[model samples]
Target: MIRRLAAFARPFSAWLAASAALRVLHLALGIAILTVAARALAAGADAVATAGTIVVLAAAKGTAHYGEQYLGHRVAFTVLARLRTDFFDALARQAPGVLHRHRSGDLAARATADVNRVEVFYAHTIAPALAAVVVALGSAGYLAAAAHPALAVISLAGAAVSGLAVPLLGRRPVRQAARRRQETRGLIAAHVADTVGGLRDLALLGAAGRWERRLGALEERAAGDTRALAARLAIRRAANTAVLAATVSAVAVAGACLWRDGQLDRQSWWAAIAVTLAMAPALTAVEAFAGESGTTVAAARRIFEIIDVPRPRVPPPPAPAPPGPSGSAPPRPAPPARAATTGPATTTGPTIIGPTIIGPTVIGPTVTGAASPAAAERRAAAVSARGVGFAYPGSPPVLAGVDLDLPPGSTTAVLGATGSGKSSLGYLLAAVLTPTHGTITLDGADLRDLPEDLIRRRVALADQRPFVFSDTIAGNLRLADPGADEDLLWHVLETVDLAEAVRALPGRLRTRLAEHGADLSGGELQRLSLAQALLRRPALLICDEVTGQLDAATEARLLDRLRRDSAGRTTVWITHRPATLRAVDQVVVLDAGRVTTPAGPRLSRAGAARPGLSPAGSPGPASLGDTPGPRGPAG
Candidate 1:
């Protein structure tokens, strides 16, 4: 982690070097000014000249101070920006999977507050330490040059005691307090965010007071830890100040003794004492940094923890083979190869090579002749899962030995009681989660071997509780299709039966929504989410309880339009709704973590009377096994 942090400073190395140099210049000028003043007072030689020299040194010191501050801050902010970008990139790679293990507020704290703390390491710690070393060595050299080697040794020893020993004495206690403070801060932030997001629910449940108590407890712990850390720091500071004063006094006394022994003249003795006094401020700066090093190091460790999360193993793109001797038929474009050899499964297709929008133009090939466009569209993705299983780390499996197939253009409904892995199955089928025990394939290509972009373009999932950003309607829809025109947006809205509602709004597509669609009715949010998904026109659409908020009439009408709009697309409807199941070609029923009815129920798209039940309007076992369903290992 230390080496990685040093790398961030590399980009601003020039600025950092200049800042350190200016700091050294500023200290050197102060020492020179003191020496000149002492010489003029002790010898009464050229007072006017001495005064002029002091004025020049003072001005130069002021200029160096300004330059040091400017360059130091420039380097600090640059390194900070780099750290933030790199940390976020690392977090993004682990998102939705590894991030689930962390608290949102804790992660937020790491990103903002923890990262900000690292500024102390670069801006206050490194360059200041370097300047202190330079000033200390220069001060000792000047004393030795003035025939006071013994005093020089004394000065160096004093610096070591103040800068090194004082910090070491307080290290353990300071570190402990800092770590506790950081943890408590994260806890409080997480609690506050959770409370705000669920304030209404907490009030309705009459549990807001309990949450308030919990928050107060966390804040109090943080305050107590901070106070303890401050008290320790204050004691350390007092000890360092006493040590500095004693060292200065020792230098003056040692110089007087040397002068009495005829080893130094009056002017030389005074100059030596002045240099030691100047060295005090330099050593004090080092002591100040040492006092805070414990907190800075603690913060650095937290930042590294996020950066070191193991990224998902995405295989590199395959390397192209070398060309044969000169004139061979310009090698035919190689077939879409699988991911790198490290991949567990082979994939084949027209590998998407660049930023290509996913729409009708990029979907898989369509079957011609008798099939309608809708049927052809559904055939674009032939997804299958073979003996698949999933489990969170250290927990029992949530899904086990599940086998399923979603032929192109087919509508499949997955049914299960609460906590029966229905949503897990949907996530797996949509390529959001990788299977721990088996393979899931899209068009005969392992889902793992497919690039993230291709999977996002080809498959769309409407979450159970969809997120609606606070933006204009057009802005929200643009997330699905960035290049979509107003016409295209209206077309999708109409398809989802939401065009009328949006048109009635004061600003139409320009209407802004509150966070999470707080400004819209629950049903309107659902339709809006459906509209966004339809805009993608993905090859496979996984709707996870998308219609749970809709009335039966709206749900039926939306499902009918979905059937028509997604003609050639594969639709996986995860629901327990009887009305929704009747329109699909097949159903998968899960219990616990296993698929209890693997074959599931089959319904004729043209003849089903009830949505999810049997012809007699009852959810009977006969409806589940009436016909053989798609059942086999994933291709």
Candidate 2:
């Protein structure tokens, strides 16, 4: 709570101090005016001078009040704007997995509405509260010594009750209300995002009305909480108000008694009244501040929650080293072992006793020749998985005791039906997620040893459907090669057969892509992703059924170029299509997280017409481990 409030004053600490000074000046003048009029009455000074003193005090108080309010608002808005930006940046930097716990509406509340509500604290409550305490204490002390001591004590009692005691009493319930309100806002934002994202599906299925009803119910609950919070605040206000009136009345009674005792003359009587009146406002200021503290504390807690979430654990060893481009010597192939997942590829269910029979890899004889075919294949240990196994936070193992290899300058077809862990495998290779067991090596170096960004530059994956940000055709193309010259960008487009489409745009490369590439056709987006992948000049390109929906002719054309461009460049093809399987060099089959028994050309389907393998697509169920996830196609 303190940090967030202080943040509001950061941009205008000078202004805050100035506003505070003005508030003090206003209060001082107000009290001074009261003293002057009282003295004028006692001394019987000229009427003009007395009236002028009162006028000056009124004018000064008016100006100071306006200045404090104006400056306070300025600071509040400036800080709030900065806070929103910082909130977005923080959310963006969070690990993808961590976002699962929060609701969109709750985040929005803290970022937008809740933070905005705290404006009063920055602009008015804080400065006024400070000035109020100072004024109240000063007046009480002055009147007690100079006018009426008992009256001063009475004012002091009221200030304590209003400032400290009453507000503290309401803190807990108010805080909970603020917390609930914040959560509701974030939940609402998330619901909106989800509903909009699925609008088309919902409309077709006639479920939009049902969702609307659910959203209405959620809104109603929020309203109920708001009413409860407001009602509590109202009660506190009424109680504090009564306390304030009684304290002021008590001070007045004390002044009358003092006058009767001849301890306070007429001048002293008026001065005591004025001081007590000045102190009265302080109690109200204190009350207001107390009421706000609860909600602010809850809001602060929500913000800290995001900042304090534990980061994803980093595995030991290192990410694999990025390999040289297609033209360079392939690094020495080590056995399947990534330094990151250091533990033995663990299998939870019934460990294989002896002779683990890890997958076989053709580790060609070592040679010194640089140009020979054997030398060219030296870099071919593109990716090797040794005893690869993984289980989520509390779920059963999705993959267990698995070993696999994809060599350099070769096309390896990865076939799996839905839920076959195909996408999880892709994510692991991409270094988007770290494995829970075993090791993954690229070009023979442990992947855990190398920087993930650098590793991905050498290995790119294209999902079946990928997001295309709204931008000009050229702008989108430049994502992979930020510094690519115009000619190079056009060349990549031509390679992916998107050159003609791009040129046909009304604004050509300058055409706006619209929100999320709504202006582009599905095929155009796929081609653009391919162009981006090509521009990276990756050694191992992974295409995860990217052409799943393309027609035969279009698929053939894209596939033809893929094979030609991928020559001597390692490639992994994940497809269910017969044509894609025939285009690759070899096929590795997976079933139930392990190469099935009878694991040669066919698996999964029994007595089913076999799809062609390398020569002809093989027809057996491809290994299905995890769902195909939507992810970045970064090499």
Every candidate's CA RMSD: 10.9, 9.4
Q: What is the TM-score of each candidate against the true structure?
A: 0.80, 0.72
Q: After TM-score superposition, what is the CA distance of residue 306 in candidate 1 from its true location, in Å?
A: 3.0
Tens-place lDDT digits, model 2, residues 1-635: 67666865776889888888788887788778877887788778899989988998899889988887788788878876766776665675442333445655557666776667767677767788778778878888897788867787888888888777888766778878867876776677778878977898999999999999989988988898898889889999998888888886887788788889888887888777766666656577777777777666666667666655532443443343343342222223322221112222322111111212212222122122312242234233377876666544455555555466675565665655455455566666665555677778887877767765767577776656667777777787788878888887877777667788888878877787887687777777777787887777777777766666566667766675554444346777776555554344455444444433222333221112333222223223432212243222211
Model 1 bad stretches (over 4 Å): 45-51, 97-100, 312-379, 408-410, 442-451, 582-585, 598-635
Model 1 TM-score (2 dp): 0.80
lDDT string for model 1 (551-620, tens) is 7777767775665456557788877555665455555666566655332233333224332344433334
User: Cα lDDT of model 2 overall?
Assistant: 0.64
Off by over 4 Å in 2: 1-23, 26-86, 102-110, 114-129, 280-282, 314-415, 428-465, 469-489, 530-544, 559-635
Q: lDDT value for candidate 1?
A: 0.72
